[model samples]
Target: MDRRVYGAEPSERDPGPKPGRAYVELVGGPLDGMLLDVTGWPPQEVVDGAVLMSEHGAFGPGGRSGYEPAEAVAGAGGVGRFVWRGDVP
Candidate 1:
């Protein structure tokens, strides 16, 4: 087996302009999947924050917005925005 080394430093790449809302969806689901509604911030920030926050129980019971990490992750799988209108409900 080959071992890979990962860096612990931040990149110098620009994130570009921020957006108004951050929409995400699950890539795959078993049968019925819940959709995640993340607004009030940029997409990148929302995605990054969601991943980090979930790890630290930010989405646990009685969280900041009453969201569970497992539920959120399960709904949106990984995390990404929608492409067309009327996609979110």
Candidate 2:
């Protein structure tokens, strides 16, 4: 049987980039160091941005972390970056 690992982790620990899977690195803000899986999304959707909810965010209950697509990094295994805009109430 083959052993495999799943879910988000620091880039340094990753074996390599996964083909056919798209990811966005959540930079800064409360949800920093997190990877958002955006697989199967078209270019436009990626640019549109995302608002993810976090129970542990600064605002506590009903808090949302907003992110906008930023420059793509090749060294990050082609993983795109999403800069934190701000937290929404």
Candidate 3:
């Protein structure tokens, strides 16, 4: 599978897998928190969906506890959740 990393720094670019498959990973933060897999979807979509879910209290106190919006996308493998810290901006 292919891999990529996104953040404030320059995002990594790599040749992806075959047309149908997607790569996924869990990004870890402090206190064992995680950022869900968002391999195939665009960053904007992930943020937008997360915001909508958050506003509606979709996942209760824990955001996207099981199946995250990104994971629900067509090419996604499965659901995953992450804990966010600090200001989103």
**Candidate 2, clashing residue pairs?**
none
Q: Relative to the unseen true structure, what is the C-alpha lDDT of residue 86 in candidate 2, on a scale of 0 to 100?
A: 87
Q: Which digits, one per residue and each the tens of the lDDT, describe model 3 over residues 1-89? A: 33332221234344223344433333232212323335677655554443212212334443332222434344444434433332121
Sequence-dependent TM-score of model 1: 0.24
Where is model 3 more than 4 Å wrong at Cα?
Answer: 1-32, 49-89
Decide which is better by TM-score, 1 or 3.
1
Lowest-sum lDDT 10-residue window in model 3: 26-35
* Model 2 lDDT tens row, 1-89: 22112243436456333666666777888777676777766667677778888666778878988888788544333677888898888
lDDT of 1 by residue, 1-89 (tens): 21111111125242222244233532222101223445445534443433211211324532222222332332333444322111111
Q: Is candidate 2 or candidate 3 better by lDDT?
A: 2
Pick out the ten consecutive residues of candidate 2 with the lowest summed lDDT. Answer: 1-10
Evaluation by TM-score, superior candidate among 2 and 3: 2
**Each candidate structure's count of clashing pairs:** 0, 0, 0
State the C-alpha lDDT per candidate.
0.30, 0.68, 0.35
Best by the lDDT measure = 2
Candidate 2's C-alpha runs over 4 A off are 1-20, 72-77
TM-score of predicted structure 2: 0.67
